[model samples]
Target: MKRALSLLGYSIVGLTSVALGGCGQSGDAAPEATEVPKDFASSGPSAKAVESQFGTPVKDRVATIGLLNKRNNLTQDLVMKTGESRRVGNVIIKLANCERTLPWENPPEVGAFVQVFVEERASVQEKLAWHKVFSGWLFKDSPSLNTVEHPVYDVWVKDCAMKFPGEEEDPAAYASSSSAAKASGKASTAPAVAPAPSASPSAAPSPAPAAVPAE
Candidate 1:
């Protein structure tokens, strides 16, 4: 009986030690942390080559973008120049370039090359961090061409303020020219009026020797 009791005690001690070792191993193991990028709002790809006739170089042009926050149903306009970035709340928007069709083009269009970053978690287990949600050219007229896919946000191009070579005609000059033409047309079409006779007595007097001569 003594031998059997001693063997049982030894077995219990070994099982308790193994269970504690397993717990220690699990406590030491941990998930690897994700490395966040230093540049959260990196620029998008380079813009396409544009001719001098196109007007406004890519870097000099300004672009307007619309940012919508679905959570609050609030939309805001973000006007930014090329190579610029703006942060609103936990989101960042970067503009690389913007473009528009020539004034004489048949189907006019405006677009902007943009990158969007949001501080959000990739998954439920992961912590919140800056992640690029979209990066590409977004068109104002044809929004379906490219879209920013995010659950809580939407971004679209509004306008690209740039001009073609002849687009910058002076408005004052145009108005003056139009007014002159209209005035000339009216003058040419008007009927001329004859002048009224003079009221002076010298012009109205006439001699009266006719009755005596008839007898």
Candidate 2:
């Protein structure tokens, strides 16, 4: 009985050590395998053509994405240009393209083609590694169309910043111009006052002239 108890205690300690070792894996570990295509994360040859009906080119467009970590209940906003990827904690998010409905379209919608990679193990026996867990278009108005089925993270599209051919001028530019105009108007309206002349010493009295005249 004593020998059996000792062996059991050693086995328990070994198992605990193994579990701790797996849990201590750092997120920076290189992934053993990546299912994403080589060109998937980049602006490949297919992206050379402009896809927007609006005048804004695809590469110039920007997108805002929301990332949530359910484990810690923390959320972060990722603003990125097309074909950009950002790594936060143990996950990497890549943006391929983002789009929105035309001004005339009914029921406007925004979307982005995103891929999410997380560093984790598939099972207890597997080593900690990177995995491409989600890849697809995430729609803002209609989220149920597709979803990120991760247990610890969630990603969604918030907005796509782009321009239509005749869309209104940029708000920032417009505000700056208005401020400049106001300044000019104030300057013009304010009356200018010339500087007053300084007082000068009076000329010497004509005493000499008067004395000569009297003499």
Candidate 3:
């Protein structure tokens, strides 16, 4: 009986030592940061493309996008503009440009060119790796046009908060133009004036012609 007990103790000690060694090896090698998508590094549009499309980049302009962390049931807005990128958790999102039709135009549409990178592990024990999961335009009104196909995340365009060339007018210029239009409208709407009374001499000549005919 004592011999069997001694053997069991030795087996427990060996298992403990193996567990400790594995822990030490894992601690020595830390996980690395996720890398950017290859497409973003290669084919992402440059600043010149922005200028060509938008005339000039509006530094203050921004596009707001909704990022859904389905794993956590959380949502956040990522505001960016042309040639801007944002990193959140295990995902990286970049905005190339955003567009919206004019208020007067029909079939209104709003869309944004977006790229998404997700960090994932090929297996449960492997380190996290990043890959481009989705890269294309997403629409605000029609999200079905394009989609992010990740099981853990979903991204959609919320709004593009940028001004177009003629979206707004200078305060002074607008006031002046408004006043001039009002003046023109008022003049066109003015009432007519009555004619002055006829002279007494014209009345006397009319009576004299009638008396001569009677005589």
Q: Is candidate 2 or candidate 3 better by lDDT?
A: 2
Tens-place lDDT digits, model 1, residues 31-144: 212222346436344444344555788878899999999999999998998877777777888888888876655477998889888898899999998888898899999999
**Candidate 3: deviation at residue 116, Å?**
0.3
Candidate 3: worst-modelled 10 consecutive residues by lDDT: 191-200
Comparing 1 with 3 on TM-score, the higher-scoring candidate is 1
Candidate 2 residue lDDT tens string, 1-215: 99999999999999999998886685544442333334444534232334855557889989999999999899999998887777787788888888988665557899988888888999999998778899888999999999999999999999999877545755246446778998998887555422222222233454557788676
lDDT of prediction 1? 0.78
Candidate 3 — which pairs collide? none
Off by over 4 Å in 1: 1-53, 170-215
Stretches of candidate 3 off by over 4 Å are 1-60, 123-126, 169-215
Error of 2 at 153 (Å): 0.3
- The C-alpha lDDT values of all candidates are 0.78, 0.79, 0.73
Cα error, candidate 1, residue 51 (Å): 6.8
**Would you give me the overall lDDT of model 3?**
0.73
TM-score of each model, paired residue for residue: 0.57, 0.57, 0.54
Could you tell me how far off, in angstroms, the CA of residue 136 lies in candidate 2 after the best superposition? 0.7
Prediction RMSDs, each to the true structure: 11.4, 14.6, 7.8
